[model samples]
Target: MPSSSVTISSKCTILPDRNSPIIKTTLKLSVSDLPMLSCHYIQKGVLLSSPPLPPDSLIPLLKRSLAATLSFFPPLAGRLSTDAAGHVHIVCNDAGVEFVHAKAKHLFVASILAPGADVPSCFKEFFVFDNTLSYAGHHMPLAGVQVTELADGVFIGCTVNHSVTDGTSFWNFFNTFAEVCRGDKKISKSPHFSRDTVFNSPAVLPLPAGGPSATFAGDEPLRERIFHFSRESILKLKLKANRKRVNTEILGKESNDGWRAVNGANGKANGAVNRTDEISSFQSLCGQLWRSVTRARKLDGSKTTTFRMAVNCRHRLEPRLEPLYFGNAIQSIPTVASIGELLSRDLHWGADRLHQNVVAHDAATVRRGVQDWESNPRLFPLGNFDGASITMGSSPRFPMYDNDFGWGRPLAVRSGKANKFDGKISAFPGRDGGGSVDLEVVLAPETMAGLENDVEFMQYVS
Candidate 1:
């Protein structure tokens, strides 16, 4: 089936208020910024207010509200540049963010939000993407916003350069824009732009010849599918993971004290795997997904599989960072195990492994990770990402659905096709605003087929 498509109606640049004093400032990029230098913008498609607005009126309101919001987020209005010494930095020169107005002729909110929906190719036209900006060393706008008019709704597509901010900061700018649209004069949180907080003691090392190209050019055929996990299903998974630990505790202590013993005890005599620091819902979900994917792929038992989770470093930093420190504050941590071990282990085993990895990242670990990046600024090896590896991104914890622009919450939130990479999984909060999880998985076609039919996998997803 041919995917539904969109048509571009108009394009313009949205700059900060011209009357505002423009400060000439440059934010020096550090080693931590090297991984995201490939001009890969994080794109999101949000279904706007239920009652769609007329194009003429909606466009002006969007433009006006965005301009007002940009005043608070100057970095989003900036551009990317490199000094004569070849060090990349963000020049806060108000280069302006690209704003495009589009019309998704036959597409509606339900069409785009439906599970297993294949978005049209032309949808990419809604956002700003220039290969030259990343590969050819040309200056690129830090942000882009494209609002598409649908028959019964609106699709607001946003793109932000990964070098400038991570998912948290992106949502920060987005929520603020929504606030402005709702006629709020002041935003709830102001972004902190002090890079000094995350400064590296040792200076960043110089880049290698040709300036570090981490972009992966591949021809492997892949497909993406979105699976929904409801609140009940997530609870079932959590229970499945915790049951093993609870059983072990009971058998060890020979006590049937129910939930009280599980909660009250520090997991000493019970022989429970430290329920005090038990596996989280996110960890349980990732573990199940990893195991399911591995089983579906039927990877060679001898091969080692890696699961890398993107960790938010705001709280990991010693003394903690300001809640609103704007920039890329995420790092990836990988856990490796043989396919045989992953398949042979119970669901709780994988959950425990993921939980341990999260527990390992302390303030010292975060500092060491920064120093390690300083020594070697190169991106993680793409060769290691075979069918056997899985990388998880975009935590459900991100407040993506909270952007209410005088309208109600988003009907659906989704990532652009540009984000579909092999062995990648993106998690978003379920529509109910409850504790459910929605997972978008991208994988080889054959693997996806197996996952679709896998009885064990289907049992936990409703």
Candidate 2:
């Protein structure tokens, strides 16, 4: 699709409904939120079948409901502020959010969901605030939504400041907006805005005069593709990862043979004593991806490869946060190993490594991570800095397909070209559900070609 194929019909700012009582206040940025200051806004959205009504009829309904939703999420309608100490905070002054209505009648849903098609470049144009960093929220809208009308469907794309919302909070706002559009009188889950649980003191961290620099290295051309693994395929991978193995002597010497322990405190694999614990489906799938991507890159055997998985800290903290806690509350836990060791190991070995790291990131470790950041705050080092790392964001467990705004459930979930770099992966629940998974993989062009042709990887892609 050419740029001329899509045209923006209208753009407006949406404020909270006047009927709702909204007080202007400031909300402190949590320890988890500070690192994202340099990151780009998260651009994600859903594709739905054509609505019963036309765009003119539906767009107004969406805008109206969005205003009501903003009443419940005051910070979203606010702007970022910096104090003399350079500490960033959200000022809830009803600054309003941007909403754009667009038309792309030439594009169809089939072209996007095609069996082995590269994600359409036109999808990026469906979102606003291209390349806008999160810190720009000081002047720009903290969030924006674009509704593009397709030939046979509609795409609702959203761009939100990463510092203010993680994948969890992003979906929470979307789900709530959908509910309001569906005429729900009561919010199923209200957001918790308290930052006390994130830290004790007013965790202050100053920033550079010009603000943090962008960490993404987009010099190399990249390819983005969505690989779907069916429910049965995921189950098969999990079963293989969990299959009982003979406690061979070789296993006992794993630690001596380049396999570093996941836990540094005890110099032993965390949760290794409970070998019977089942490997989660997520761990198994990610393990396969790590191995396949490594092979695709064709890196040197001695090169170190890292897989970073964003873990939700809300529940992992000592005092569990309210499930509805409404801000960034996630951290990336990296699992590292040499390419040779990772590729040579069995699926279970890699899966076990990922499982151990996740299990070891308990409350104490979470607190320690916070303290370390308080001591020295810096932006998240995103992108494949070493050309040998994969950072996985988003999750298959998020309620992605539930954004039914009077229209039918969404047919698929897609993302814009924000915060994308080589080795960046986003996971979404398969449209068919039932434990299925879809991985939106971004990689160097050559590596992607190799991955597409790799028999081992293609064999599991459904």
Q: After superposition, how far is residue 420 of candidate 2 from its true place, in Å?
A: 0.6
Each prediction's TM-score versus the true structure: 0.88, 0.91
Model 1 accuracy (lDDT, Cα): 0.69
Worst 10 residues of 1 by lDDT: 262-271
Once superposed on the true structure, which residue ranges of model 1 sit more than 4 Å away at CA? 1-3, 18-22, 49-52, 116-125, 130-138, 199-202, 205-214, 244-275, 380-384
RMSD of 1: 5.8
Best by lDDT: 2
Report the error of model 1 at residue 48, Å: 2.4
Which segments of candidate 2 are over 4 A away from where they belong?
1-4, 19-22, 244-276
**For candidate 1, lDDT tens digit of each residue in 1-462?**
334566778889888866334357867665555566654677876777544566787789989998888888887787666667666767777778889888776665565555555444444555656332232223556788898777678778888877677777888899888888888877898888777766433454465655555455544677777788876565556667766433445443422222221111110011122235666556777778889899998878999888877777776677777778778776777888899998998988887787787667667887888877776766544322566888777766667788888868888786775545678787777777566667877888898888888888888776
